[model samples]
Target: MIWSVISLLMPFNLEVMVNQGYLAERSGYWGFLLQHPLNSLFEGGLVHLWFLPALMIAVAIMALLIRQQKTHWMLPIAIGLYLYGEFAGSSAVVTGMSAPIYTRNGPFFSTLFVVVGYLIRERHILWQSRSALLLAMLGMAFHFVEAYGLHQYGQVFNTNDYLFGTTLWAIGLFLFLLAKPDLGRKPWGFSLSQSILGFYVSHLLVVIMMMNLARFLGLAGLEKDTLVLFGTLLTTYLLVKGLERTPLKHLLFR
Candidate 1:
């Protein structure tokens, strides 16, 4: 939260940065910072912060269910909720209502994945098997097909679609990782993991800055994107490593 707030206070504005021609309408730094707490709390705020609150809610719900010895029912209930979300999206055509409500409703939309994670952890499900790999591949293929179908129908593809096949893909990939014995033993693994949160919070600002720099240098398309990605990653990694040894680490990362 602290990192997110600090990032939002930066001069960079994603809304203006992306719009390019609308830079004149960008909010002043103080105004943007003041408005961001509300936006962050309600509208996901600063790119990826939505995952934090969404995960919080999902984890709370899972904790309550587990505490009540309702673990067996959790997965089934989550599946049913996911299916309802999907149906709600489809029904938008007939009801004249928005189809992607579930996506926007972070708590509800995030529950299924949270439940899946809990089930996997509690059951000690392993993903190293050949069957799991094949299933994961199939799930990814199905996710693409579903996404394409949604695009063809002129409806926005949202989280419900992801919940369908993407969920399976994630499960398979997660299991596959679990099946591996030496996945996190790399020399840089500890530093990388420690710095990951900082990277997540800071990378968007770096990307925005790098993209603008790229454009100013006459770069375009893939060249711009590649530069932005690599530049952001390198800068964020260094920033996190530097901060890790400083007094500000607690304020920024803890």
Candidate 2:
């Protein structure tokens, strides 16, 4: 749950991931929250407001009430609203109701994926069939096509993210479908959480250093954008290596 909340808050201001084009739009939400933690409790301007955190708080309260009453369905509904509401609304709201499929918000809808992951842990479902594997492969094909399309289209990328979303949903939903069998393995191959830490902290370090370098270089136009990307990855590797030996290791992995 702590990780879930942290993941939920990640996109609101991930200056690092935004450059990587992960959840750029959702940065507005996280940014607003970070800038005005109090105002975020209420509302804001025409852009991002407090509705999301409000909803989260509301869900928390409802969950408490349900817990007091010992209800089960509320858990699913609470989790579902947190998941689906964010899933459906993030892409919709971010792109002004145009692209309804991209997972460019936060980990809201991804929360469902995590839950399915938990189910995999409990039920041992992925080994039952190869359908999920086939779906994942197909979805990857489409995801690549859509990403390539975005790269080709360039500035018009926002208008075409729906294709990206469709592909992601195909892959994501298929993954969920196969969750029952594939996710609950006893001896996992690698540590996803560790990888996330390395990626997250390293990425943030890169973004910060790149931003500072860009300001110093005064590199305007396409050169600036290109440099930022290059600098981010370079710094990421350097920071990842440096952090491995620091006391902050727990901050990344824990």
lDDT scores in order: 0.68, 0.50
* Model 1 Cα shift for residue 240 (angstroms): 1.3
For every candidate, C-alpha RMSD to the true structure in Å: 4.5, 9.9
TM-score of each: 0.79, 0.47
List model 1 lDDT by residue over 1-254, tens digit each: 77556555555644464666334434554455455454445434366666677778778877888899888887777777666655566434433544333343455557888898777887888764676777789899888787667666566666333536777787787777778758788878975887877777767777878976886788998998889889888887888888889998888777
lDDT of 1 at 197: 78
Give the range where candidate 2 is weakest over 10 consecutive residues by summed lDDT: 42-51
The clash count for each model shown is 1, 8
**Candidate 2 on 1-254: residue-level lDDT in tens?**
22334444444334455566656645655675567544433432212223344445555554565568744444475365444543344333343433222232333343343444444555655542356556656666775565565455342434432343343455455555565544545444243334545765346435646766776677887888888888887766666667677986676545
Task: Give the Cα RMSD of candidate 2.
Answer: 9.9
Model 2 steric clash pairs = 12-30, 12-31, 125-180, 125-181, 126-180, 126-181, 126-182, 127-181
- Candidate 1: where are CA atoms >4 Å away? 13-42, 87-105, 156-163
Kindly state the number of residue pairs that clash in model 1: 1
